[model samples]
Target: MKPILTATVVAALVAIALPAVAQNASQIARVRGGASCAGCNLFQASLSGLEARGLNLSGARLRQADLSLTVMNRTRFSNADLRDVEAYGGVFSSSNFSGANLTNASFVGAYLQGARFSGATLTGVNFSGASLQRATGLTQSRLNQACGDEATQLPVGLSIPRC
Candidate 1:
């Protein structure tokens, strides 16, 4: 009985520590590689200047990540947690951001042409100097909470609100 209890405690501790270990491994991989942490916990990771095109990051936790100047064209970010992410000057053209949490994300000068943001949260997102031409799933209510400028391009029939 005592051995069984110790084994159970060890199992529980391993389970609890696994996620942290995985997160650390993912961070190391991102540094060694080009920020390619698919389905990994990258919470609050600073991936500035990352140049990983066509990388798959689906279901990854990237909340509060700094992705400034990253080149992630055609990358997949579906269902990723991107709340408070700073993607200024990042080129994410044709990227998939479906069902991602993008609350308070900054996309200033980011190129998002033909990107898919279906069902993603857009509260307080900054689109200043960003291009959203041909982007999908954007609503007026969501845009109302976003900040954009004249240089920001929207989808057809979508008008930009005053910043």
Candidate 2:
């Protein structure tokens, strides 16, 4: 009876730990797979300092993820859930962010030149010190929903609302 109880307790602990282990393994697999995390569930993951040019991250769940200082030029982030993400100092030049949920995301000191923001939800997004020069599909309504400082460089003919 004692051995059976111990075995059951061990099994219960293993079961409880398996999900976390699996999550970590999944993150590791995505990182190992050349930074292409399309349709991956990377919620609240710390992906800072990743240098992955042209990374395909479409439809990925990056809610509250830390993408600080990552260099992801021309990455595809269409339809990704990026709510409350912290992307400070990241370089995402020419990336496709169409239809992404960028609510409350911060891109402070990031370089986002020519990145597309079409159909993205930009409520409360912060672009402080970020560059969006020549970016496409940005509307005044969306810009109004976002916040930026004077250091935020916008596309020609487009202006940022007072932050």
lDDT of 2 at 4: 54
Question: Which clashing pairs does model 2 show?
Answer: none
RMSD of each: 4.8, 5.0
Question: How close to the true structure is residue 56 of candidate 2, measured as C-alpha lDDT?
Answer: 84
**Worst window of 10 by summed lDDT in candidate 2:** 19-28
**At residue 86, what lDDT does model 2 achieve?**
97
The estimated TM-scores of all candidates read 0.80, 0.82
Show model 1 residue runs off by greater than 4 Å.
1-25
lDDT of 1 by residue, 108-145 (tens): 99999989988888888889999998898888877887
Off by over 4 Å in 2: 1-24
What is the C-alpha local distance difference test score of candidate 2?
0.86
